[model samples]
Target: MKINSKKVTVQKSSQALCEYLSDVKNFEALMPDNISKFELIRDDAFVFALKGMPEIALEVKEVEAPHKVMLGALSDKIPFQLTANIETINANTSQVELVFEGDFNPMMAMMIKSPITKFLETLAGNLEQIQ
Candidate 1:
């Protein structure tokens, strides 16, 4: 599996950060406009109907109130598990860390890694812009 992580500190109250992070809908808004379609299914997962974005479906595996949230995903083509962790630094700051683990066959690793990295980058960029 390919692994990538990023940390972003938002200059907002942790309560507000937690509120936004807890809502899957906020991701849709924070994510780049290039994502034409995105939805969090009732199963506590998000599905991106388009390809080449990143994990096809992301499942919310764990959540710690006002502190951390973890989501796991298996690449659409590869057999790797992608886990993203968002942690709150304090009432006025927060950080996000991502971990992708699995034994993916050859080239699929490259294909999956790039987009995941890009998404995390975009997420951090968006978070920095968020008050």
Candidate 2:
């Protein structure tokens, strides 16, 4: 399953946003308010739990400077990759897009599509306010 978030314009430059996201500690500001637990185990790894979901470990898999950052699930329960792409709009503005790609059975995909879509959209919208 693959879901793409709506693009959002942010007041910060791509470089600034990239710098912020490059540090896992700054992710707290971008997380959903319902998050029950969050821990940064290393510079590139962390564990977090949502209101009713099992704990999930995520690791930053790759980064392309101010262009893109890719993160992947480190838990077997959920196999997925989340990518944040940043595009420079001007010296002080950027366009950001989020994509979630998950490996799910057809039945599971049908059931969680709406919720996952909403989650991705919310994440993107929240990220827009990072400046």
| RMSD of each candidate relative to the true structure | 3.2, 1.3
Candidate 2 lDDT tens digits, 31-81: 888889999988898998889877878889988989898889988687998
TM-score, structure 1 vs. true: 0.71
TM-score of every model versus the real structure? 0.71, 0.93
Off by over 4 Å in 2: none
lDDT of 1 by residue, 1-131 (tens): 65666666778665677566666666776676578678877556677643445436766666676666665563455444544455667756667655666576668767667766776677768877876
lDDT score of residue 107 within candidate 1: 82
Q: How many backbone collisions does model 1 have?
A: 1
Best candidate (score: lDDT): 2
Error of 1 at 95 (Å): 3.0
lDDT to native, each model: 0.64, 0.86
